[model samples]
Target: METHDSLLARIAPAPGQCSRTILDPATGTPVGEAPVHTVEDLEAAVAAAAAAQPAWAALGHDARSAALLKAADAVERSAEELARLLSREQGKPLNGPNARFEVGACAAWLRATATTPLDPETVVDDGETRAELHYRPIGVVGAIGPWNWPMMITTWQIAPALRMGNTVVVKPSEYTPLSVLALTAVINEELPEGLLTVISGGPDVGEALASHPAIGKVMFTGSTATGKAIIRSSADTVKRLTLELGGNDAGIVLPDADPKAIAQDLFWGAFINTGQTCAALKRLYVHDSLYDAVCEELAAVAAAMPMGNGLDENNVLGPLQNQQQYDILARLVDAARDAGARILLGGNPDPGQPGNFYPTTLVADIDNNNPLVTEEQFGPALPIIRYTTIDQAIAMANALDVGLGASVWSPDVSAAREVAARLQAGTVWINKHGAVDPRIPFGGAKQSGYGLEFGTEGLKALGQPQIINGWTATQTRATPN
Candidate 1:
């Protein structure tokens, strides 16, 4: 098998002293050379997509659905190799929770999107007059995906866009571009050339894709700051956008909840993907009656989970995917400690550690005002805040600039759902957290970002709405300028 480095070098720009090396976060070893693309590269890709989208869309829904399903099959066939590459590049453990699952999710999403129907609806019918609403493809879609869950999130953007008949030009994160490139190769076998192009680079490439005049829609999944930048860049073109940005999600533990039963679920909810998830539970607000018990239970679970390199089968949690995130998390933990929050578990990074590994940390008695609780610490550290009343907990949770996801934990399903309805988030869970489905729409509210990502609403977001109206000969028609 050709090495990842060699595979990437074939498509990369001419070898230069300035070429950026993609480091394997697990070992800090150079795994691939990411292409440094210019505005020309982005323009060429967008132009190709602009030319290809009409024919692809003209093939109609059935043909497009068949191609997507075939692409899904190709992805499944190469799942193992892709999963291995993903673990090496993204620092997600291959066997345990999410690395393999992420790769498999790409295939699953493609299949689901391939079959999700988008039939024309008869909006009005009054015997003599009738009207129908149609969903038509919106030219080329520019997809800028994040590094965490690289392949799955990329598919989350492209699959629906393609299913809705829009050709795509994707720019994956430079840190983990190879897996997306590899997955694109598999997909291209079933898709038409230029229908799904992968261009890898830093901000320059992303900026070009977002602002390109040929691109009709931009689908982005990243930090709120970057999402805002894309919105501004695309503003001149008045491009359609579907932005899935950051989230500092809060998970509340009601006084009636059982800490022991919910401990394992809560721990994984916050720490999945090594707590590098944008929608992971960053803050936990527990009722004072159950706060201490919840803290101890959560601490015990965190202590038991193994954290190490992604290749190790025994390790469920891997290192932070990059140094920047590691530093941010470390600073947040330090601030929490200085603010008088009690550290119930791991709080420091091991200087001797080979990778960017911050231990699974739990800080208790922190207030909502603490930076650790307020900011989206996309790492392994979680702050546990104490709340005296349910209203206080809900208020504290909703105080942040972000409102992506929130959850309520209680034994009474009815009571839990009542509180869930009050939480200001795109998706509120009764017991679980961050369990999103393709059949349901998922997007952020407020500064978190806008536009849904899945389901009928999301599918339609990628297309333009066209309405056809007809009247009987009995109705008089007037010509208007």
Candidate 2:
């Protein structure tokens, strides 16, 4: 395993700025330090990507795909080492359904993206007229990745851009930049110099990248407020953007769903990654008939699962990645409790604990207006609201301004499919929550931000369409001469 010191060296902060300590969220201890980059450093990285992009684009899909496949191999080889760093920094358990899973996913996504192709299409073909549409790479993609699932999300943003022929300057979330930088180093070994680079810092670096004149596009994953700021910043350049912003994803359980059978799936759906996921089942609306049983079964399942330091292999969950998020969750839970919401399990914070540990909390009987239900907690807490009718449930689910993902749970697949179709989310699942496939496209609808990620549509979003038309020689001569 690479030492924290060695990994720290991989991050490039600006020359004058001091390094910032990265904490192990599992123990609240110092994991390593990441450099705090300045606007100048961000600009330099952008410039380097801009310089390398044309050549990268010239290499075409075959060569770029080959390089990405090699990077995937490196990621697989370093999976163990990267998973440990990921566990410490990102606060996900090292095994089971957490850090290792994310590492494996990173490699899988890279391979999938490497194989996915965007071939030019003939829009029109006749004897005298022929038009072809080509997906051309946009230069210098500034990828600002979020802290939650940093490795996989970063891979989601950059791999496609790189595979589609654009060079990237990535600035990972300050709280979880270590694993990203480390993973970047592994991928960089197979990539050309300046083709992919990492700049570690806070909002300033992100702002600089978003507003920079030379950056052709900005691909961001975070809050809606921040996404809007990026939109405003990118206006001057009219840069292409893919913003996968905040999601208050809702999961509706039909009266027909067997509460006992779906209990485990429901528990993991909401609490996976300690409920830090953007598309995690945040608010659950259950038909009133199954509401109490669903709550009881979900609470039982959640209570049985172990939550502790992420390094322990037996633990399935870990701490919140940072204090800011922890406090936000704490306040929301407190407000819900004060409003007479029944806390089925794990509502309070363990203030004496070394880590930012909030137990897997489930609140029952909360109305749609409850703060916990209304806001995006983005932590290990779920508010289970009871609804009398499917119409009511659907109405409540779509009421939120953000719509990244939603799910319908029922025994009848056909019935579930009917309900799923009405969901306002980008990705709606039946009997499942946040299952994403490389072959399927995923993105937000409404205020959750625009553009798709994953699949062919996602690959196409990283590029611009250029149409070439062939005209008859006689027609051209008559017009010109």
Which candidate has the top score in lDDT? Answer: 2
lDDT (Cα, tens digit) per residue for candidate 1, span 1-481: 5444444555565656235677888788877666666667778888899888889999988999999999999888878778877888899998766788998899989998988888899989887788999999999999999989899999999999998889999999977888888889878989988899988767888998889888899999999999989999999999999888899999999999999999999998899999988788889999999888999999999999999888788889998999999999999999999989999999978898787889999998887899998888999999999999999999999998899999999999999998988888988988888988888999988888999988888899999999999886688677898
In angstroms, how far off is 37's CA in candidate 1?
1.8
Candidate 1's error at 426, in angstroms? Answer: 0.7
Please give the distance, in angstroms, between residue 210's alpha carbon in candidate 2 and its true position after superposition. Answer: 0.4
RMSD, every candidate, angstroms: 1.9, 1.8
Candidate 2's TM-score: 0.96
Q: For each candidate, give its TM-score against the true structure.
A: 0.96, 0.96
> Lowest-lDDT window of 10 residues in candidate 2?
472-481
Minimum summed lDDT over a 10-residue window in model 1 is located at 2-11
lDDT of 1 at 279: 83
Q: Which stretches of candidate 1 lie over 4 Å from their true place?
A: 1-18, 478-481
RMSD of model 2, in Å? 1.8
